[model samples]
Target: MAEGLFGVHAAALEVRSQRMGVLASNIANASTPNFKARDIDFTTALNAVESQPGGVGADLGGAVKYRVPTNPSMDGNTVELSTEQTAFAENAVQYQSTLAFLNGRIGQITRALKGE
Candidate 1:
């Protein structure tokens, strides 16, 4: 029952949260020399987790990858501040949505258990 409740959204939420962290790191290092921006392939990571029998938790370290910069910097830094900010914002929204879904699922489960 709990496993079904957290099936896909749990994995998606973890991926989104990991992506947000990566985007934040990229934004934070935008001014640093030769700092390469990194991100996760959300679909791939989510798929991997969802394919597993156990519902995915917060473990998302291996899904990280380097971002290909549209405009390469002279200092070899790939951290584009605007792009990173946009990605971060999008990921944050997705994370919130997933969280809401999880909360709703929990609420439904609670209500059902109470026979309400």
Candidate 2:
């Protein structure tokens, strides 16, 4: 489990961070003349990451399919700004937590290396 996490945790964190950024952008542009709301299918992205050898992070060139709107806005706006912003905030918190754990793991490794 530790090995898997050590390899994949970073990938999960990165994907989540990417999702947060996209969601935040969507929210920020919500009032920008009919922007349509965008969302990341986190489940799909996670699955995609898990399926790849060493996880998707191993292949930075690999493309993950986004949850694009099947029904786009008439004004070419797809961002539902409020929803995106809320999601962004939530994801950011999660990202921070994940980072904390990853950092903690690194700290533990450092201590172990020092024979602490």
Candidate 3:
């Protein structure tokens, strides 16, 4: 019952959290030479998680792919400051949203258990 309650949102939260780390890494490496920006494909990851049992951490990052920069850099660095920052901010928001949803679900479950 607990497992059913959590469902895909739980998996989404985990993936979003992991994605935050990846995005942060991209932002941090923006100026580093030859550093390539990378991100996780959330849809693919979510699908993978839903398809298999005990799939929370099962190849969670197998869908990680490199970002294609809009502007080419001479230093061979793929991390663009603007792009990385934007992606980071977006990912952060999504992470927060997912956390909020999970929190709400937990609250509902708690209330139910308490007969509220």
Summarize candidate 2's per-residue lDDT along 5-90 as a digit string, tens digits.
47667777867877876676776776576555556667677666676665645333234333355556667776655556667788
Q: Which stretches of candidate 3 lie over 4 Å from their true place?
A: none
Q: What does candidate 1's lDDT look like per residue over 34-106, in tens digits?
A: 9999999887788767766664464555677899999999999999888898888888888999899999999
State model 3's lDDT. 0.82
Residue pairs in candidate 2 whose N, alpha carbon or C atoms collide under 3 angstroms = 34-77, 35-77, 35-78, 35-79, 36-77, 36-78, 36-79, 37-78, 37-79, 37-80
1 or 3: which has the higher TM-score? Answer: 3
Q: What stretches of model 1 exceed 4 Å from their correct place? A: 52-62
Give the per-residue lDDT digits (tens) of candidate 3, residues 19-113.
88888998888789999899999998788777777666757667799999899799999988887788778888888887888899889989999
Q: Looking at candidate 2, what is the lDDT of residue 36?
A: 54
Candidate 1 TM-score over all chains jointly: 0.87
Collision count of model 1: 0
Model with the higher TM-score, candidate 1 or 2:
1
Clashing pairs in 3: none
Candidate ordering by TM-score (highest first): 3, 1, 2
